[model samples]
Target: MFFSKLVMAALAATVLAEKTPVTPLLLANFERYAAFASAAYSSDCANPPFNSTVVRYINDVPTDTQATLFRDDIAQQFIISFRGTSDIQDFVTDLDQVLVPCVAQGIQCPTCLCWQGYLIQYNAVANTVKSAIDAGLLQYPGYSLVVTGHSMGGALASLAAASLDGQGLPLIAYTYGQPRTGNQAYANLIDSAFNGTMYRLTHTNDGVPQIPAQSDGYRHHSREYWQSDDPPTIENTFQCQGQEPSDCNQSEPGYGIGNGGIGINAAHLSYFGISTGNPLDPNAAC
Candidate 1:
């Protein structure tokens, strides 16, 4: 009985120790790390700072799915960074926004209809991650896992984070310019699952975050961190209530699809300090 009690105590302590807290410094590093992983989808970057730490890369092709696993022995951390939509099929997947029953294993799940394409793609990427994580557990016994991505990749990261959370793994996720992933039910489920561990960031007038349209019963995760068009600074941000608010992404009028050509393009591409160009027209959406 004494031995069993000691074992239980040890297990409890391990669980408590696994939860990694999010800080400003950590978020800044993760945002850059996620960008580097996202770029790997488009370019062959040479001698990137994160290249040395990539223990595994999951690229499930003839589809736009890619992820990188960075294991830092010095910090004892394991991070899974997902790549965003890269091609026509990916954009087609995003626009094919039909929500069907989120059923699995012969049972009807609460949420009706997840994004069919994204869900299919996310599962493929997640299968690879699951196998990698299982092996990583044996290799790096107490390492914490952090997941991050941008745009469509961010949506997939959210799904992956929630699914992994089910296995009792402590989750820390950071996603930028993420669109609404699912219906209200799906959002509710994931929000509660990742409650404090997820930080979903949306820059000013980012139309991507304003979609897959809340009018269709789609919703965002709670406590969204809204960065401003003014300038990138920690002081120039706001954590909006629930999903939409006057001060966040929904602040602008119209469908939030953006107005002019520059506006539409700028809204989607400017997150993480990657600028498309300054508008020839001063009034272009920021």
Candidate 2:
């Protein structure tokens, strides 16, 4: 009987040792939405700009079928707190000039001020991360907190990442077509703080990341592209090179673009429905 009890204890210990880290789960959840946004952008390339009412619906009406589905289906996957906010339109309007070509081609435009809202939203998210950490979410030391979003959401994700990094939180953020939120210095600081924890997913020739830098110092990450015909998978084709932790190389492939380039039309839209890669496959390397 003593031997059997010892065997049971060993098995329990083994099970505990084998548990998956929460950090990866959080990162995976972020990547999942990025993949979804990629698909959504591709499918809706021809849709019109988001009107004010549509934006309102997305932000205010949590009970709306689509919003609820997005929250229930996606947000719950990780311990994420989502705050839907307006001002995505303002970002689009601000970058109206450089985004014209992509906008005309039906690619979505990523907005600048939308990132501002994200910064606001991140204050809450940052607190959550702090609370989680204080509560011992990182007791395993391998657990990670993640934040993700699609299109404008992606842009916001980047901002949140920066804020979290400032607070010295361990976070991994995956954003799709996240536009340029600030100057080169800002991007560099974020990259340095987050290290390999930030991944930006972009498709071939997508224009959202191509925003004209306000200064010569502004430089975005180097992108890894997924072939248009490839299936969505977490492979080296989907990672981008940011400004820090030189050895942090990883990849994944997927669809989506946040609108931004040369015009008002491309403003305030999220790309959907394109084929690329799965952001959450454990077997895949990126």
Show where candidate 2 strays beyond 4 Å. Answer: 1-31, 35-143, 212-218, 222-230, 233-286
- State every prediction's TM-score relative to the real structure: 0.77, 0.46
- The candidate maximizing TM-score is 1
lDDT, candidate 2, 106-173, per-residue tens:
11223222233334433434444445444544343444455555444555556656655555666666
Largest lDDT belongs to which candidate?
1
> In model 1, what lDDT does residue 46 have?
41
Residue 234 lDDT in candidate 2: 40
Candidate 2, residue 134: Cα displacement in angstroms equals: 7.3
lDDT of each: 0.65, 0.38
Provide the clashing-pair count of each candidate structure: 3, 39
TM-score, candidate 2, is: 0.46
